[model samples]
Target: MNEFELIQNIFKASVMANTQGRKDILLGIGDDCAQVQVPQGQSLVFSMDTLVEGRHFPFDADPVDIGYRAVATCVSDLAAMGAKPAFFTLGLTIPKSDPQWLAGLAQGMAELAEPIGLTLLGGDTTKGPLTLTLQVHGYVEVRQTPLRSNAKVGDDVYVTGLLGDAAAAVPIVTGEVLVSNERLDYFYDRYWRPTPRLIVGMALKRVVNAMMDISDGLAQDIQHILKASNVGARLEADRVPISAELRQWQPESALSLALTGGDDYELCFTASKEQASEIQLITQTLSLPCTKVGEVASEGFSIEGYDGDISGWQHF
Candidate 1:
């Protein structure tokens, strides 16, 4: 099918599903450009992510997972900044015009976008080696914008939800190792469909002094905050929040995955000591496990009881 027909048949549902009563989006998909209105006194936040086939995912992975992950990863950035998800545009590079694949991809995008109140703002489709690039937009109150460079010395560092599940799924996805169906399913879901902590991020806007998502492993990602904030940290090995699934399935690699595994997508944030109680309340309210893994200090980054590779994922 042609591009126009493909969009009409498959992408229309993604565009129209969230159309009712959406005043923020003045125009979406099929228009020359998407028009949006940033709420009064709120700043617009936007982020983009591109996933390449062989480099980012297994060569023959599910198209539906690709579609969902493309959106989720980009939205993860907005969540870090405590912004409410808005709309997104997609840039697709495909090797062929496969109708079934396109339909599944569109379905994947709609399912994730609809519940989050995200809209399709139209984008470009090109012929290439099967890549997906998504640009997501969000809105946040000016006074509450979370930044990576605001960690105060002595602030407690925290992470939302379990870590390392996605990284643990790499071997399974690439067929490097074998595991039970239940374990495979759990890690695979974490790998392909990461939950963006937008709710906790929004709630953290008033609490956290510094914040970021753990896409490139907690170890390496934490350094970004330390450098930006001009502070160091002492991560407690015992305190890192890890998934039971990871420990149960791969006991030996569990800690490594939790410490340095990329693609966790969980929030890594720092907040003042006085705000600890409030932070606990926020996580409890959202029912997400928030753990204090470290404390911000004047200089130096090190983890107690661990002297291994802490660098997270890097393309090179």
Candidate 2:
């Protein structure tokens, strides 16, 4: 089939199949640029992420998982900003049209979108090496959006849920580790499907001074908060939560992996000492486990067991 016909048959149908409640989408597919309307008194918070085969995921990875991860990662950004997810646009580049692959991908994306009230508005398809990009939009009350720069020196550092499982899962997913079926499934799910802490972020909006989702390890993500807030931190190694699965595998490296390895997608936030009691109450109400791992400081970032040095993921 020709390129245009291929897109019409595969891409166009894929776009139309996922139905979401998006009244403001004035124009969607078949337009040069999709148009959307923003309601008054609400500010838009948008983010985009690109995932390339081999770099972001294994070349042989399931297309469905790839699609789910692409959407989840981008939506996590919205969650960090304490925004209500609205809609999204996708940009897919592939070498050829594959109906089975596209169907699986659409199914995965629909699974995530349906749960979170997100709608797929529009996107473009092109011929290239496999790549997926998602641009997500969300809404926040005017002047009420959280930012990374708002953290204060005396604020307590916190993270939701356990860490390190996703990092530890990598080797197993790539077949570097031979684990039992149960352990294998656990690790694979942790790596492939991350639950973005959207509800927690929304509830903690006014309470959290600064917040971010841990995409590139706790240590590295915290650095972004530190730099933006013009402060340092002292993270306690023992206080950082590590999963039982991760602890069982490499107890010695548990702290290191939790602090340095990536793909946790949990919220790292800061609240004042006075707000600690309230923070506890909120977490309990939401049933989301949160830990006070450290406190923001004046000078530089340091982890308790790391001898006053910070060791985390480095892209370079």
Candidate 3:
């Protein structure tokens, strides 16, 4: 089909299904330029991410999972900022317009975005390598949104959910490893369908002094908070949470993956020790595990219980 036909039949239809209650979206698909109404007393927040074939996903990966991941990972930025998801615009580049593949992608995007009430505002489609760029928009209270630059010394560092699973799944995704069906499913979900931790993030906005998502492994990502806030950290290496699935599969490397492996999409945040109880209460209400992995320090960064080179996903 042609570009207009492809969008009208597939992408536009997907947007319509997800845009029902999105009053914030003034003008969505079919417009020359989409318009949105930012909530009063709140600031607009946005982030864009690009996923390319072979780099972001395997060439043989299912388009459904790819689409879902494109939305989930990008929306993680909103969660990191403690923002409520609003709408997104997509920029699609493909070598060819395959109707079936495009349909699966649309279906997958809707599956994840519908429940969250995130709608597609608008975007562009072009011919090129297989790549997808999603720019997510959200809203946060002007003064309440947490930032990386606000962490303070003596604040406790915490992360939501277990880590290392997605990093471990990389090998499997690349056909470099094989495992049982159950384990395969777990790792695949971890890699391809990460939860954005939005509820936890919004709840912790007041509780945490600083907040950011762990896209590039805890070791590398935590340092970002430190640098941005002009502080140092002392991480209890053993405290970094690792999934049972990953520990059982790679006991020797589980810790490393938790520390240096990327794509976990979990939130790494900091809060005053006095707020520990409140943090616990909030996470408990959500039934999500939030673990204390470290504490802010006066000067330099260090990881207790292990001495190794600290590195993460290198985009370069």
Most accurate candidate by lDDT: 3
- lDDT of each residue in 124-205, candidate 2, tens digit only: 7888999888999998898778799999989999999999888888888777789999999899999999988889899899
Q: Which pairs clash inside model 3?
A: none
Q: Name model 1 segments beyond 4 Å from true.
A: none
Give per-model CA RMSD.
1.3, 2.0, 1.1
Candidate 3 — worst ten consecutive residues by lDDT sum?
15-24
Across 209-244, the per-residue lDDT of candidate 1 in tens digits comes to 999999999999999999999999999988988888
| Model 1, position 303: C-alpha lDDT score | 94
User: What RMSD does model 2 have?
Assistant: 2.0
Worst 10 residues of 1 by lDDT: 7-16
Q: How much RMSD separates candidate 1 from the native structure?
A: 1.3
Tens-place lDDT digits, model 3, residues 1-316: 7676766578777854667666677776776888788878889999999999999889978989999999999999999999998888899998888888899999899988888878877788888999999999889999999999999999999999999999999988887998899989999899999999999999999889999999999999999999999999999989999988888999999999999998999999999999999999999999999999989998799999978778899997
